[model samples]
Target chain A: MSLLRLRRASLSYPAGGGSVEVLRDVDLTIRRGEFVTVLGRSGAGKTSLLNLAAGFVAPSSGAVEVDGRPVTGPGADRAVVFQDDALLPWLDASENVAFPLRLKGAGRAERLERAAALLRLVGLEGHERKNLWELSGGQRQRLGIARAIAAEPEFLLMDEPLGALDAMTRDRMQELLLKVWRASGAGALLITHSVEEALFLGTRVVVMEPRPGRIGLDEGLDFSARFLEGVPARALKAEPAFIAARERLIAAIHAEEAA
Target chain B: MTVSATNLPERAASRFPSGGRPALPAAFLRRLPVFAALFTLTAVFGLWWIASARGWAPPVFLPSPDRVWKAAQIAADTGYASATLGQHAAASLGRVMAALLVTLLIAVPAGFVLALSPVGRGLLDPLIEFIRPLPPLAYLPLVIIWFGIGEGSKILVISVAMFAPIAISTAFGVGSASESQVRAARSFGASRFQTLRHVLLPAALPSIISGVRIALGAGWTTLVASELVAASRGLGYMIQSAAQFLVTDMVIVGILAISLFAFGFEILFRLIERFWLPWSRRR
Candidate 1:
């Protein structure tokens, strides 16, 4: 509930005849109410970093710990929002959201109530019974979040949840994400290739380096915090300070790629 | 061909005052395939009628459609080989459906195991492959020897013939779940069983329905082969009896009945798919 930490974690996959190191002694942490955005070029182990934190893959060296306990496998404490949305097409909106509850052995009535409430929380109340295919990419992503949060996990791990949305919807979804984060008070770790998205959303942003991926830069930012303090997202993002930081992160990623 | 030309913004409606002969009416054009089917049936029937009337071979060899129809009426009245046409038809249908049910229960679970567990696949994959290519006739005698020439053996023969398609298709459907989908389920604390139930099962449904479609065809075909061994009341038995006595019209009637019944079930399964997995149609 308080802290999720990766303590010098590394992962490598046996490929061909040799092993390819995916993450090299990566160190990171997210506290409750903190939104940590990871930004990097492709192959920078951004996803591997999240996978370690979410316990989808075991770190070959060191450890991922939520609070202080070592992470072993995927659990109810860590829910992930996949880039592809990954909502079951066979399930309607409400049923998809209710899935986590069902897995946890919640009774049908309780699951339905929780799902219906989460649908409202995600601004998908009226579309509860709608098929997943009928929902737009943005709406489906929102439903994915609802499903992820259905179990009230300690942390929310998202892999480019809004990466597929059109520009207008992406911008709108960014604000919605902040709203949900503020409401849930769950620690969040999101990875994206977009520097502006990283700069705009993260309370702390971590930039990753590729080819034996490692952390290149880690810093705290006040933009998302300020937005949560009732500043309009557009006005805050248009600020000169925001523009300067976005440029700096973009430069860092490109500079790493060139290296 | 002129669709693009007529749709251009620069074109005026008056440029084609009659809308190009009304384009053969959209509904009528849509039914063109139906017309083609009807035409083919009629042409075949006409050719057969003409051939029989002119003594093309002998009525004993190629019976006219009316002769087949009269044979059907006569079978309905006097029965064939100790059973009426209705009874024979019912017996054939019952055997196939029983085999289908048995195969579905066994084969679907076998499919799930073969797909989910490597050891299960290792154990079952070769067996399914072994049964897949074995014609029902090849196995019918073996089944009769094992289970005896009773309803059980006949059903078993048909069920074994259906086993491979249903099981293989189930495995194929189970494999269709995306990596992220499985990962998502696990992240929600879904156990292996829960994941299989919630994600893999529904994901496999469209494929399972299709597998059943193929399996039903196998079931019907194998029903005839199975009935070859001491079947007293089936369309296949009636046809076999008719063939021995040179009742060519009755044989034609049996073949037509089987074909029509198979075609009817195919349509029925399609409608079930439409109703149950309506989302599958989006693809």
Candidate 2:
């Protein structure tokens, strides 16, 4: 199986006098079809980690590689969904989804057909012709996911893409994200502040501690797999084992914060 | 436009005024400003008519409304200086449009260069700043001396006046593209060219259209001034000639023609914007 590996990666930025290290010697590896969630507090450099994987930022040390090949910069192999959705306002919904295909030089008709299919898959059926401004926050985030998968990327890197949604919408989107990840067959690296979300969505939840950001906990869970195996989201969330895992992750993040 | 239910029934009834009497037409209330504009125009024209008819001002200085109207009819029919009013209007419009096209072609790319590249901005920034404040007329003599009294020189002078507004606005629009927007495109492996075309260009379009409107305004003024110097078949030239001969009515007719054409262009631009960038205003 293909894998994305960030081996002892470090990132820093210039500050007054000396440089400030935002992420230091963080080692992470994601296997194909795996869902990896990076949970963190405000200053945890969780976004920085996602950026590193997406090749938007270079590591100050070590490497980010795909299948042992060094990742140079953002390429077609990785697609990112941003927190704000970032759907191009100028294009209609389908056209926005087709944008990555367009960049890959896909023909017009093929691009349209693929975009229509993807939008339908993302539960935006009949919204193909609508302007992006007409979409609700949740719908736009769904479109963002559709666009990310349109590239048929090996990795889907998302940075709190559902952060702006209401509680109800966020719950629905979490399930939708699980379905998309399975359908796309891409390794997922998602960053979020919600501990329950990390637990529910991720096959492996890696909690990052802030202030010289580093991964404080890396634990594997089968909740996402269980959800796929006919377990309803509500039932799974209310399970005693699920609660224990959620509480443990929360405690771990809080302890890291206090320390 | 929905009428949501109100809590206070008494206040709602009072607002409508008992016996189920209807309120004023919504259209009338909406069109109040338009009616006010018409009234203002009528009042201004009424004052001008009375002033000229009562000889409150010299006829040569302010011709009567009828005299100006007659002059307009004559200019349209019999022509002025071997060219009819239509021809003069067309000539002026053609010059401005040509200048606008040339300005857009150059300025948009220049704007991207200015915004995207430090070296390019360093080189072009001071030059744009220098060109922006000075009026086209300031360089008209220079252009005439260098390029002579050709149509090219006229178009060149007008285009220069049109440049800064468009270029600066384009740069501003490009800058307004959010970081996530560009990064999303880049994540799809969009090349530099693709990013600019699919991402930055559309992002910049609304501002570019507004800049074109401002550039057109600047170009119109420059066209008039340039024609005042060395043009034979434009509204400005007709106005200049009519003024020299003390034909105040013809001059007024010329001025009205220019105003009408400019207003028409503004409406045309609005329609174009609505057609192409429909989401711009909605967003």
Model 2 CA deviation exceeding 4 Å by range: B1-25
Residue-wise C-alpha lDDT for candidate 1, range A39-73, written one tens digit per residue? 98899999999889888899999999987989889
Using TM-score, give the best candidate's number.
Answer: 2
Give, for candidate 1 chain A, the lowest lDDT window spanning 10 residues. A250-259
Candidate 2 chain A: 10-residue stretch with minimal lDDT: A250-259
Best by DockQ: 2
Runs in model 1 deviating more than 4 A are B1-22
**TM-score, predicted candidate 2 vs. hidden true structure:** 0.93
Q: List the residue pairs that clash in candidate 1.
A: none
